[model samples]
Target: MITEPLEGFLPLFRSWFDTAAMAEKVGVSGSPENLLVELDLGPMVEAELRLLNHTPANAAEAACMLEVVRQNMGDAGRSDGLDLRAVAAVQRWLADQSTNEAEGQPVERLLRRARV
Candidate 1:
């Protein structure tokens, strides 16, 4: 049997994050791991979300993904390999975007921090 692609859930998670305004509206906080636990996504989906979000070339995409991850993890500690400086950067950007929805903030801001 073929296993499902964890990345496939990225869009779905992103939609929820945007619709629910998870970070700001839900009062979720801390690293993505914490949010993932809160959202009850379990360890696997949480890991997949974090990897995809942190790997994205665009900051907004990364942020959007981060929001979902954070919402799911809640205020719990992160799993090994899930916590990194680059990952933290993406999470911070997502937090910033969640707080400021104004269009004035250039989208390029998101791409600047991308590892690629």
Candidate 2:
């Protein structure tokens, strides 16, 4: 199965980190894993949506996906495998996400830290 869309991808990554101790030794943070994926997904999802001609017909599903992405993005905890450059990209994306004071101070702090 392709899995249940947005949720399972994070776990697969976590499992990889669990086994790949070398990524840990090399200074990587798994904290931003989901956020990294979330950022990358924007274009991919858009393209897929375009191809399928699917306009997110279900409001609840759309809301769920958006919420999950935001939660992941905001979680700036240091895990493993996330480097400075990777975090920098996440920082840029988070900055873009903070439109019209939508994210508040805590999220801002997370964004700053994400810059590593």
Candidate 3:
């Protein structure tokens, strides 16, 4: 039955479904949640980096790539796909950058390094 597969997976899917429904109900234009679904996760990672002001040259490149991905997604009329690895990598890099900044290292100097 159609319910068979859902019966097993409903618990896992329920939260996600509820979130989507709530987002729709809120219906705020240009909300981050809406933009998030429209944005490639890779570029979203870069955007997060920008927010943290930890944009290395490589991170800038990644951001540009993500922009292209966003454009392509727009053209294709599809939501941007999420890449968990890219998000994690960017988050880790941001954390490292924050640590370096706290240690009194200039962000510009750290950006030029092989490591964050």
6-107, model 3: which lDDT tens digit per residue? Answer: 222233223433444454566536757564456334543343333222222245533533443443344572243333333433444454555544333344
lDDT of 3 at 28: 31
Tell me how far the alpha carbon of residue 89 in candidate 2 is from the true structure, in angstroms, after superposition. 1.4
**Count of residue pairs whose backbone atoms collide, per candidate:** 13, 8, 0
lDDT for position 24 in model 2: 32
- Clashing residue pairs for model 3: none
Q: Model 2: per-residue lDDT, tens digit, 11-104? A: 4334433433343344344566533433333444343222222112234333433433443345562243223223343343454454443354
- lDDT of residue 93 for candidate 2: 40
Q: Which residue runs of candidate 3 sit more than 4 Å off their true CA positions?
A: 1-57, 65-82, 101-116
Ranking by lDDT: 1, 3, 2
- What ranking emerges by TM-score with the best candidate at the front? 1, 2, 3
Q: How far is each candidate from the true structure, as Cα RMSD in Å? A: 12.2, 15.0, 15.8
List, residue by residue over 24-98, the lDDT tens digit for candidate 1: 555545666555336653544544444544544456556655654564456472464353433554545554554
Candidate 3, residue 106: how far the Cα is off, in Å: 19
Give Cα-based local distance difference scores for all models: 0.48, 0.37, 0.39
Candidate 2, residue 27: the lDDT equals: 36
Q: Candidate 2's error at 102, in angstroms? A: 15
Error of 1 at 65 (Å): 3.4
